[model samples]
Target: MSKYFKKADLILFIIILALSVLGFILLRKPASDNAQIEISIGGEVTEVHNLDTDAEYIIETEHGYNTIQVKSGQVRVISADCPNKDCLNFGAISKEGQIILCLPHKLAVRIIGGEEGLDAVSY
Candidate 1:
């Protein structure tokens, strides 16, 4: 057992683990400040709302309607008339680049304009 297990080997394993954790934390993107929600329908910019203000907005499209709520610096779809209602399951988003889409209604709500990250990704 001593031949296979050494103190140096244990120290090296711990060092590798610590470095991995640190790398993960440093590489992860942080949430943005002064974020705002952008609402678009049919590729047209309809409206934008600040996350800091608490309000409710109803977006009416040719297909249907969606109710959006902004409160406590977070935005979410409180209710919608879409068939799937998938937007409601998105909960709340306060981070930049986060989006909630209602495909059936052609509605797209996204958080933008604060501490933007890398615009493109390379494999």
Candidate 2:
């Protein structure tokens, strides 16, 4: 061939670069430092916690009990009396949109503004 790199190759490279930059912008995640945690029990909002400070919280509902620990702008379920320790094993989450769910206890712990994916309109 006369050319080692054709015009098609250059066009393809430009297309890939453009797509990568667009993808990065579209999927950019929210910062977790200013995020908040939402605790939902039995489909109701039980508590809200700010990630700026460290604290410990005990949750007791008609279903069961759970102990939540927050430190260094991260949150996790440390202890739970539920039969399964699934929620406790979720570990610490310092990212937006992370979640810990306790099915038997009907509890859901999630961080707001931490989703690292495209939103509804973008999706």
Cα-based TM-score, every candidate: 0.66, 0.66
| Clash totals in order | 0, 1
Candidate 2's residue-wise lDDT over 1-123, tens digit each?
A: 245888888899899999998876664455454577889997899888887669998999888899999888878999999998999889987766667899999999887863345455475
Candidate 1 Cα deviation (angstroms), residue 38 = 0.3
| Clashing pairs in model 1, backbone N/Cα/C closer than 3 A | none
Q: How does candidate 1 score on lDDT?
A: 0.83
Best by lDDT: 1
Worst 10 residues of 1 by lDDT: 114-123
Cα error, residue 31 of model 1, in Å, equals 4.6
lDDT of 1 by residue, 19-90 (tens): 988876664334456577899998888998877889999998789899999988788999999999999988
Model 2 pairs in collision: 96-114
lDDT of each: 0.83, 0.81
Q: Show the lowest summed lDDT stretch of 10 residues, model 2.
A: 114-123
